[model samples]
Target: MTVRDDPRIAMLSVHTSPLDQPGTGDAGGMNVYVTELSQALARRGAQVEIFTRATSSAQPTKVEVAERVLVRHVAAGPFEGLDKNDLPGQLCAFTAGVLRAEARRAVGWYDVVHTHYWLSGQVGWLAADRWDVPLVHTMHTLARVKNAALAPGDAPEPLGRIIGEEQVVEEADALVANTDAEASDLVADYHADPARVHVVAPGVDLEVFSPGTLGRPALRAALGLPADDRIVLFAGRVQPLKAPDLLVRAMGVLAERGEAVPTLVVLGGASGRPTAVRELEALAYQVGVADRLVVRPPVGREVLAQYFRAADVVAVPSHNESFGLVAAEAQATGTPVVAAAVGGLRTIVEDGVSGVLVPDHDPRTWARALADLLGDDVRRAALAAGARRASARFGWDAAAEQMLKVYELAAQVRSAR
Candidate 1:
């Protein structure tokens, strides 16, 4: 707000571009976070530019996302999709591209470099050094944390990524976390200095995801969903860590018991690795619930809001989540969420209030919770009301305000150094 706090942020999201679509490829919450936060920061009077690896030749090298928020696609590796594990090998190339971009700008083009994920943090280290600025990093997901809670068939994270993240933890001038628990993880697991870690929660767009935009019947009709069917929606990547299979298993349970099952629609694309959709289909056939399960590709945000509005409840059964933005967006649309009690989801979904939190990842528990909520309109209505009220308290504007303070801290640290 003051001239002294006008941070010229050079955001680094090396592995995934903010211009990329969410719920597909490697672009999930982190991409949404960067895209929204940068725009919000720009609205609050900061000049921002995002730097990301160019994923394909079709995309232009430069794009203007907002009034003063520009996204620069730095050519690093081949202009094609590469596995996330292989991205580490391209760090030097990415760093070179970043420095080349900086060289083209004036000396004060960027006053501070803010990085998302460890891949970006790796690139941010060199950028911060070259620009003589502070580095603030957000580890959206920790390798060790995900490895410890791998889903049924999910592979453990490699040792190399763990080492890379540890180095980033050490090098970052300040670490930003989505929740207090995540902040504690940095201190306990990564040995981050307590004073250097800040807890800054991500936000949802109220203008787009607000409740009461459309009636459920009309919205479902627009999507061609059966009017008689009670829809249960799941929106995110189809990866095992997200536990899309868990939702399928719950549907199977409902069918086996001869109880009327709500139509389960899973909307998302494959993540880094192939999801278990095929295996889930086989399981659905084995359990006689194939007809009740539907899987569709991810939709745009506005269409996604319609899907959220059409649903009786949204399920988020992830094995691990940094903040569960999908859950928040759904809740903002007046849909109750049934999410796993993990990470920031604990705070996002108020157990027995806005939504129920199943402590364990068992399918039976999820099935019962879904069945009860679907059968009881009174309880679901209460939670739906609570969901809208609770979500109104947080938005992108609030997140941008908090991040400005974190930027000031990073700037202060740079001056001290």
Candidate 2:
């Protein structure tokens, strides 16, 4: 059987399950990336079996998330209360489960193994070596890249993670990056072989996140948001890396300037820390913009699209992102994004076109950008139109096609070795 003709894939996402809700605990864009990409590959005739650590006991051993796609929950340690930092210790147990599952099947059951994140890469390294299949890894976020742009009071990624990522980069037959910048980082920072690194941009679900039929005013009314008030939306985990606190401070800057402070709607939950969301609220209160701040839990994609449509502009002030999924999704919904100029976000948002790109995380700078964009309806409309066009460059089908090619290359590399 040819690689293009329905290759069976063993996909590993060790830290976060595809079925978990994003914007909460451990789950984020990486979860969405895996879930959506798997379905896209399945639609293209690939049979994908995703292995994720079981987070809850109630979860079945295997679940069919989409036709031709199965999510296998491997029990490694305690289902709950295991922090992400502790996951490295459970790699041996998780690897055992993956090998046992594949052992039950015939030899050569999986054509290739694709893993997301460094933790999964550790497991994939073993599984791929045992099965004699090519290993393809996507480092959703690199420890070095994140540590270089660490937010205030945020801890640097542990040394263990950095070592694990470097090892994975060395061993993997193919390394997938969400942007060219990331691919360059792999080569320059991690000293990865340039020939093995591939750039396959993650895609947005345009069908679910498209511009709706109703106008912003109508959408706001439907969402129970005040129609007359200007709205700025922040959708992601309330974590230091995401820089939601920067948005609150920007709101404070706007208020202090006696400008019309747009309601800053934060749509996400705490991540890493249990009190993250509450702390964000406290910051908003201290900034004297608490009344203008609204915190909402992250919702499903369909409902999230509604929230995107209801806002005048979407703010993505992340300190770093491998790929800014929220910015891409908002642009797909015809909402202009004001995102920080960092990592993949620099590629996702087009400055003065689809959205404005802030060069720094300064609250006053963000306030000025937000104020100027919100005050000018003509510019906002122009950007909204450009946002849709810019977002068109990314699609799941296109991403899947590119990924299939990468898989084929990985297979060839493994065979030659």
Candidate 3:
């Protein structure tokens, strides 16, 4: 797998757009990862084209996001948003469009095809077979892993997804995992070939998310947060797996104890179940901490940086995460995080170092951790100062270099086959 040449890559993200704002709709860390990594690859002299299902009628067929990185929007399904569960039926059409796009180019246009998510893997399989290229797949969150971590009152992942993901795991020429834990999940749960599985940790953009860019007190006042109250923020999609309600319930614990509860500021768009935010609102009312809760939609990266800087501590209470990008982003802004100690979060947030990690999903345990981090200014400040240093371990340039190695490995394997 050592012989190397200039590689042309076909990046497939079938269901979501890399241009979309993360933490909203169906876009999250996967979008940021693909967009940032592809840009990095392009900068490193790789010919990259990102293919996504066109969700709107107004989008141009091709957009040049960077100097050589192109986004080719291929129309496959209806021009309106459809549930992810119903996306499999459209993969055939997406695959046709991808092949047609490749047909317009020379025979050796794409040396490797990398797909994000299970839906794109289905299309990548067909395209890569037709193009005679290696297929590398990334499953951001495995269906089986997510189903096992379903929050209380949350619906389980569909059976169709579980079956599709299983097939993707079996068929991919190489699987790119965000962490060793995720790689283990593929090996143990789906029996993925250990030799073909590569654990390449994700990277954060230090340029966009850096420390000491904003004044915390002024930004908090601008965002309408109380100056004195502790602000425990959650900035991501509002879904059952994200467990925004758990943060609200933890606030309830502090409220019942007659302590000044940390204001749980949730900032993101409604996703997955339509009743996600409403369900959280209802639970907040039931817990009698509704007054301390604040929910807002997504914002630009600059404003998001402000929110991160203003926060006393960011809480990532997801049931599971392949990698917690928001935790990394927040840490890059010099804010400590209190995250659920599960999946890649275990690697992102070091206990008693950059941030505090809560072990159990129990509301009381989260309450205790949040209270301790919020109450102790000296310890919190120490974490805040060290947070940027922790985030320095991962940078997008390094990620792209590692991915180039994966591409070469996959290509060498394909050549052997």
Overall lDDT per candidate, in order of appearance: 0.88, 0.94, 0.88
Model 1, 137-196: lDDT tens per residue?
999999888887889877898898889899988888889999988988889988998999
Q: Candidate 1: how many backbone clashes? A: 0
lDDT of 2 by residue, 1-417 (tens): 236479899999999999999998889999999999999999999999999999889999999999999999999999999989999999999999999999999988999999999999999999999988899999999999999999999999999999999999999999999999999999999999999999999999999999989887877877888889999999989999999999999989988989899998988999989999999999999989999999999999998999999999999999999999999999999999999999999999999999999999999999999999999999999999999999999999999999999999998888877
Off by over 4 Å in 3: 1-5
Best by lDDT: 2
lDDT of 3 by residue, 271-361 (tens): 9877778878898999999888889888878888889999999999999999999999999999999999999999999888899989989
Q: In terms of TM-score, which candidate is stronger, 2 or 3?
A: 2
Off by over 4 Å in 2: 1-4
Q: Give the per-residue Cα lDDT of candidate 2 at 183.
A: 97
Query: So what's the TM-score on candidate 2?
Result: 0.99
Candidate order, TM-score descending:
2, 1, 3
Clashes of each: 0, 0, 0
